[model samples]
Target: MDCCSPSRRQALLWAGVAAAPLAFAAAEPGAAAAAMPKDALLVTDAEVVTVTDSSVVITWFTGSATQTDRYGAPAPVPADTELLLGEPGNPGSTRTVYHDTAPTAFHHAEVHGLDPGRTYAFTARSAGQDAQQSTLQFPGTGGSSDAPGVFTTLQPPPGRYLFTLALSNDLHMGEQTAGIITGNWPPAFQQDPGLPPYPEVMLEALLDDLRKPDRGAEVLLVAGDLTSEAKPGDVARVRQLLDGWGTLGTDYFVARGNHDRPHVGADYAACTPIPYATDHHDCWGDVFPYPRQTLSVHQVGGLRIVGLDTTTLDAAGGTLDDGQLADLAAELRRDKDRPTLLFGHHPVTYESAVTTAAGPAFDLDQTKARQLEALYHRTPGVFLHHSGHTHRNKRTFMEESQSVEFLEVAATKEYPGGCSLVRVFTGGYQVNFYKTRADLARQWSQRTRGEYYGIWPHYTLGTIADRNHTVVRDLSGLTALRPR
Candidate 1:
């Protein structure tokens, strides 16, 4: 299937760019400018990552690192990250905050305790000194900045509790390799004999965490890639693990992933693919509730939870057949007032700090992505779109077409292993990430940092502070369903 037109995507999407550089003049050898080390504090790529009514995360790179990939890749030099933040000109109210010490050239920090809908000025103090005037300011931007780079806080989510859910994805059960796709090979990735395989150990740990009482999640959702392959044994193991949490379809929900797609093989001759659905593989739709249960819905409080079978019938990429799309449209059209939570295995829009060929292919085809977007906007109650193919934690809000937050979560079977707890309230909702406390799970997360190559810490645990922040949304349209 064809991806969306480049012109369409470009016209619809908005993103932040690296901070503009400042012009400098030649100075005498004895001048402070000449005296500063060439490697002295320099901040680049500083832009907003996450924003809410009370908190904002500004991430940037320092020194001279030739960082390529967005995740796992660290900055080149060690610099102390600091933020001088306050309302435009209130020097007395300004606070100086610093980031933790890591060898990474990247610096990210979230500042809390601000009023909603207010403009604030922020600048970086990286390396050993405050940012010099090498940053250019945008023209006519609101809020004043000494060096340029400021943001306005957004309205927080509603202030009442309605429901909660747990989400995890891409466990990749029955896999023998660790970090092979990590661009660079690390020795520790080779699972030493006698260890009860990384996937098993990590998954067990994940299950233990999500079941904790404090989580209080009424529903558990596995976004996709339930197994490394759609083999019978792997499928059975995943079902068994899920049953440990609760009865499937009642307490938890799942979607099929590309890795879980049926493949041509002679393991057994009795299995045949279903029409318009399961033609390529011998597993999945036959053994599990896919395609057959492709369009399933569950209700919690006043919300409608919808799951989509985005897995392709023949390719590794994802797509929704005419039947699936039509069903989704009918469901949304049935009740426009009920808020919805949609989960799937593929992302609607590719989210990446750096562009790569894999971005588009890694997500649902562009044409389908747009179709889903239009559907969501037309329905309006679809507030949250959860997906898990990229194996990273990033949240994006669609402001123009409609107000929906799209979250991409990390793999539960590797580094940054864990799940997200979504707390919904009468006022709004908050989605927070938890690094599963399972000892083996924690160990595996660190061990697999090599999987992300050297960029692991930069994207996983080290970035946890920003990854675990809150989201406050507008829920006025969602009237609670009283006892009927």
Candidate 2:
């Protein structure tokens, strides 16, 4: 709700940008003209997002409305936006990506036809100002570390053919926390939810996208944190929205999140509590009727997916007691060759530059993470771990384990708002993030780009398939199953 408008530090915002003087100027402190000229309209908060092997997007803000807080969204800029691109240091080779006719602050331009593992240069001119001279670096294996602004592209998947799965998380139904609950941003931003409750509207769009006749996804996977405060109304609301997709427990699968864990609330206490051996659940005991158990297994597309309740009674992070770990270990031992994926709310390991929610509570505790890593070491069938707590798109290849691919999906309800569609090919699997197609989802995503020091959107929304990725896996175990 911290949607305050600010102005100041307009020069500081773009001062240390990665420009090398080809198109943007490097500001020197104490120099009268060298500084960003207080009144000058220069590109600030420029970034590349939604990157893929064939394309990349560049965005920036114009105007003097600077963000003065560490964790809030700023209002849209007061001008139109445009961008220019070309070979680094060569303006003549430049081509225009696109242009905006309307005067809007938050501007983005997607440049297509980029080769994988290649590098090119470009400049973003918006608000009548140029951002740091940047390069369109594609992803490739084993590149020089010394190269500046080099981005690596994911390798192709292992095979081809098969059904796909849709994955999403952190819907945070009924919570007012901005980033924690998508679409609940500051009022000053003036982003209309299009439909009354923005979260519900956005979630509906996500499900709608998954049901598209042409979408390859055959199963729906909700990682966790389905509700904000685990309210009965909120849980019911989420269930109602999900009903649009199909019958629960069959069309889609879910796991528990900290926010959905059992808690003490009079309003949510009416339903009978589900039985838990350790008494660690909240109102969830009575909330969710299907997938009745936190630790449950489901089969889809010939893959065995495990959902766990990592949330402890009071910790923000998750805990895997010795007993639970042992059980998981035993499960893997039973069918070591099954194509398996584990879904939970808190990630095993999450990295974020912004101190949005600081604490070990933000991720799996050290002991649990180590245990999971050790478990992954021997579980070759485990190809992926999908989690949601961080509400950002991050794919970490567990080099040590060399088996599981860990992906942190963006929140479904807010900034960088969208869900990930995973296309499972016999050769390999590819995950592409998509914002809910509703106009409200688009407006909220653009408006909240200023969250977490104005650079928040860059990470949550992901840069160059950073949020979207393709992985090569030993899917021979799945070869026996045909796409249903």
Lowest summed lDDT across 10 adjacent residues in model 2 is found at 1-10
Local error of candidate 1 at 458, Å? 3.8
Q: Which has the greatest lDDT?
A: 1
User: What tens digits encode model 2's per-residue C-alpha lDDT throughout 25-49?
Assistant: 2232122112335455435656554
Q: lDDT score, residue 460, model 1?
A: 39
Candidate 1 per-residue C-alpha lDDT over 42-97 given as tens digits, one digit per residue, 9 for 90 to 100: 45545454455576666555543222222322223555668778677766776675
Relative to the unseen true structure, what is the C-alpha lDDT of residue 225 in candidate 1, on a scale of 0 to 100? Answer: 86
